[model samples]
Target: MSSSAVGHVISLGCRLNLAESETIRTLIASNDVVVINSCAVTNEAVRQTRKAIRRARRERPAAQLVVTGCAAQMDPAGFTAMPEVDRVVGNAEKLLPASWTSHAPALVQDIMAVRQTAPHLAASFSAHARAFVEVQNGCDHRCTFCAIPFGRGNSRSVPAGAVVDRIAALVDAGHREIVLTGVDLTSYGPDLPGAPTLGLLIERILTRTKVERLRLSSLDGIEIDDRLFALLTQEQRMLPHVHLSLQAGDDLILKRMKRRHSRGQSVALVERLKRARPEIAIGADIIAGFPTEAEAHAANTRALIDDCDIVHAHIFPYSPRAGTPAARMPQLPPATITARAAALRASAARRRAAWLDAQRGTVQRVLVERPGDRGHAGNFAEVRLPPHEVGTIATVKIERAQDGKLIGMPA
Candidate 1:
């Protein structure tokens, strides 16, 4: 091992999760040890995390194999069962030191002794030219279909000054783009002494930091509020793309799911945002088959998305998560969920195609991430002139739309 290695998940289920892992990486990088970042989102994810711990143990034979992330947060006990693991901790604030124990026992204690320690707060870009920063850590809203609230606690905001310093550090590291991510990004700054709002936080970054082209991860309808939207409209650095949670369009289903926001509110957010920025690409997430969602609800969702002019949609079929209130909610046969998911997927495909088509001939400043399927683009889209040498930025003119991606030529 390079030093004292600690492991974390590499690939994650969402962009927010990816950002969180990068935060964890920066924390341990300064300690001068081999930090094993994981890339296992599938069943292989568990295998890889476990394997890395074993390898690290073999190399050091005494280094601490501290595990964290969705997999570890979701299944700490399972991961601790691995003989290589010296310490077992949940998603709590305390950094459980393996020195306290030879092997982790049944982690039954709350460990309330650990105050919320922000891990370094120094953000690092997982890629070449851009970094992902987190301004919030946990979630307060509970959608029936998600287990994030269990892994991550109630909404907790990162201090605004810390965020500003982190942004400056990222900029100093030569990153041109920064995507602010969190469990609830809108909830940022409430826990701080001054309690400056997310608006002020962004204002600080824009006015103070030199980082270019700031983007945001997933957002909720109610969180946008009025002031944030106004800032979004005015800010050139803030990306035009937004992925808001629009789980379903039916009001009754939304109530049952405990989404706490009405479809009208989501629609209004879209309308105001589009009015403010006409070319803005709006994206949404839809649960094709919620526990008690009706056929009409699905239809309503499709209609709502179409009306909102959403450029893209991510369709989920309501996976049953363990230890969540939704797991015990109700029933829908697997085949039906699958069929509805397929239908929604078809709609999303068309939605993306139409959006890209509208952008044809318009120039977009594209940040070319890693390579992808065929000769297609990576992370963000439309990289013209060959499969891109990652870390370079190029202006691309939307030439055509194909297979949910924007195919483009050099502008």
Candidate 2:
């Protein structure tokens, strides 16, 4: 790894996988090799995967093209069959190259025992000097509409000590803000022997490290408990943002989707979060036009979302994958799916506008990730800046909202 060779990583999935790739970037032993983490998380994922391979191969024709992550894990034949890919490893095997340490013994050194990787994201694109740190990988849930179970199996958590060490490194790397990403971050550390919950893991992070701003990627509706919510409420540094995967707002659709939380339960949970973290940017993932979904069911969804105080929404139409149970179920008509998705997208835009309207004339601490004309927005939120450093954090008074960004002037 010390030798000059360009090493690039390709990731194709959710934030958990992306965070894992980030960890790989932090610790790879070669400064000479450029690391590129690619992503593919949809129907276009296969196309993108091929495209990434072609691009990587063209640039580094002699370099080893290691295919890994969900696409590689689930469909090794398809990934390795590509002439560009030299080696095929499952999601777990991809992180191996990053385990190379100077202190590693010559003979007995093996990262197989090192277990889960808790690499803090270093080269974050966040406008603020922030980074993402993966606290865990893999999933235990078997949501009927998902292929993740086929992609990443089981629930194995990173060790508490190792997680703390990675956070220390991230802080040393000048990352003032850190986001913890995982498939089911709420289910963090359950696989460990001592049964350290995410709350316990977070307690360690906040108490042990100097990480300024800490945020979570997404939370499963069923996993939020008093302890974790309490920690977020208590910590000022914990960013006021929670992305809840509200796959469906209708109870019938939710039941079919196999989301553990009932519609009422989800609504109640959102209300609870609103009460505890009022200023929190509560977001949801809505799967519009699910199989067997009626027009009335979708109506209920829009109504529920409207009433939920959800500020941000990412709506995905049911895209049936071959392996998922939903794929075998009565499929939603593609045209219907498209219609519902468009409606939901418009609704989300309205929600964004409403949320931005609420923020006008208020002061928000924005994390300036890039240099504009001058300064930048906080929280990596964009704004015309006084052109400061990429990692600069600035407090700005919001004048208005424009083009999905909170426009502000220096506070």
Candidate 3:
């Protein structure tokens, strides 16, 4: 338990949530307060949020338990109905200092009306070796299966100047690696002046800052423009790992999901990336058993694990969220969804194992994470190494692969 006198900030869901949680942590001065930053990406995510609320209440009986984040923003009354919750704060209000101490029991604003991106200006994260900077927020696309737009509003971006300044400050504060994160990462900069693209923002950061290792969050395969593609493949400072938001692999399923990318486009993008940089690793988010998904559809998604060479895969079973268009579609049986999810997970595990095995006897530069025993390679391969100084980049020689991780010694 890393509890301090300022209290506990429990963040759930995406990397953006983790980044916001750090900012939330900095705002709290009150004691005996437990802030639950919740997620509502899926029905299962909402259930987990409720479970976390109950558990946090049990853990801190006397503390003022506050619920905030996407879940709270989507359904404030539902969280407010919980006996364990003292206050329910929305995504828009959670970062504001007044929300924490306000007497109002429920504070949720009209998320769609919000135009400006909240500046999460927290300079440092004491617990992490890599700092995550939220350069964008919200999503412009309304995918059939997603309810996140209701929670996060329309797309908005922090200006490139502000983002570069933030990255520069983090680098000056000794953060060696800076990860640019957002809800729709590739959809960044369209809302800002001069309508800069994400590629231009990265180019500015590289030109303006002395940041050593720059990484990106999940990107939409369809959004990779020519300029961004070149920087991703050629820039030495930019990490070689690319995670795509490819929800499904079947073209029909992707169309039904309202995704912009086709199956062939995603595959070709990865192929192009690998052709330019062989060391570049591919990560993707693939969903199993979407609405009206047949066995052939599931097969296509499974094939994507191999076709895209997805070494880092985030597989989710189809969970119909309330108010999503996909929820109104013909639903799959619970057992079928669970079985397909398991199958996809098994495929992903096998692919990941093979990738790790192929990494044996290779030399890698690893960014040592907290506690110093392990770190991740530039390609985002997890490596277990001897104790080293946390946050220091170490060159390691791979010895073996064990339990889905590369075991190595510092070179």
Candidate 4:
């Protein structure tokens, strides 16, 4: 329950949403208000958003409740119907200062009609050690199970100059790491003049800015361009951890989900990445028990975790959204979906444990985010060490792995 002169902002969903909430915090000016930056990635996400809104109302009874983000953008009337909500702002409208006025009611516009991304500049992030710069926004692809495209409009990118300048500013502010985030990160720059690639953007940032560590958010494996692949192999500042948007591992399921890459293609891409950089760590977002998923299909996805040497996996049990194509497909039983999700998680836990064990005795560069013993290593693995200066990157000699984190001392 952090407070400002205006209000408290509660963020949900991806890092992109969290970045937006930071901007929202700077816009409004009423202490008696509470704004919920929501998520609509899954049905469960919507439920959680609603739960947060209600809880906020109970805690701050007099605070005016404002609902915004993908969930609100997708279904404005639904949130406006809530008795606790006083206003509903869309994804596009939430950034505007006018929408924060007490007079504003529901400011949702046609998201599909939006073509250009208006840059939201922030000098710093809420976290001290790292900051996120939004290089792109919206998604062009229409995955059958995703509602994000409708929540966010067609693909638009922030100009390269603006991005480089922002990175330089964050670096000057003493941030040790900078993360480039977007709705569809790899699709960056196609809409801009000359249609420069994301690789070109990265090159410009590295050359023009004094950024120490640069990381990218989730990316589609099929979109890894040749130039980007080269940079990954050659660049030391580019972090060696990649979290892929590989929703399912079976070819048939992937086709049904309208994913661009095939099972073989995904595996091949991971192989190439590992070959280029042996120290690289792989992670993925996998949906368990997707529509029409069988035991064999689930098994293929589970097998892919080991095949790709994926150490971190985000396992989602399929939840039908209101308007997605998958929601209209033949649905699996609740029990079946739950059981398969559990199995996938259990398999992922074993793989993660093995990967952690392998890190023992290895020296790692950890960027400390907390005062005591918490931070993330270069591979994005959570690590615990002796007290170190916050916002400083320290070298640690890994000695043990426990409770999903690596334990180490200063090297």
Candidate 3: minimum summed lDDT over ten consecutive residues — where? Answer: 1-10
Instruction: Return whichever of 1 and 2 wins on lDDT.
Output: 2
lDDT of 4: 0.89
Question: Order of all candidates by lDDT, from best down to worst?
Answer: 3, 4, 2, 1
- List pairs with backbone clashes in candidate 4: 6-30
Provide the overall lDDT of each model, using Cα atoms, as 2-decimal numbers. Answer: 0.66, 0.70, 0.92, 0.89
Give the runs in model 1 whose Cα sits over 4 Å from its true position.
Answer: 1-9, 26-67, 82-89, 92-123, 126-128, 371-384, 387-389
Question: Could you estimate the TM-score for every candidate?
Answer: 0.81, 0.86, 0.98, 0.97
| Model 3 whole-model lDDT (C-alpha atoms) | 0.92
Please give the distance, in angstroms, between residue 138's alpha carbon in candidate 4 and its true position after superposition.
0.8
lDDT winner among the candidates?
A: 3
In model 2, state the lDDT of residue 26: 53
Which ranking of candidates, highest TM-score first?
3, 4, 2, 1
lDDT by residue for model 2 (1-411), tens: 323455455555566666766656555634433333433345556567778778877777666566666666667777657777655655665566543332221112222333454454444433235666777766778888887656666666778887788888778777777778776788887668788999889989999999888888878868877788887666788878878888888999999988888888888887887787777777788888889999999887887667776767878877876678888898778999999989888877888788887788878776656444433232334455455566656777888878877777778
Summing lDDT over every window of 10 consecutive residues in candidate 1, give the lowest-scoring window. 372-381
lDDT of 2 at 401: 77
List residue ranges in candidate 4 displaced over 4 A.
Answer: 2-6
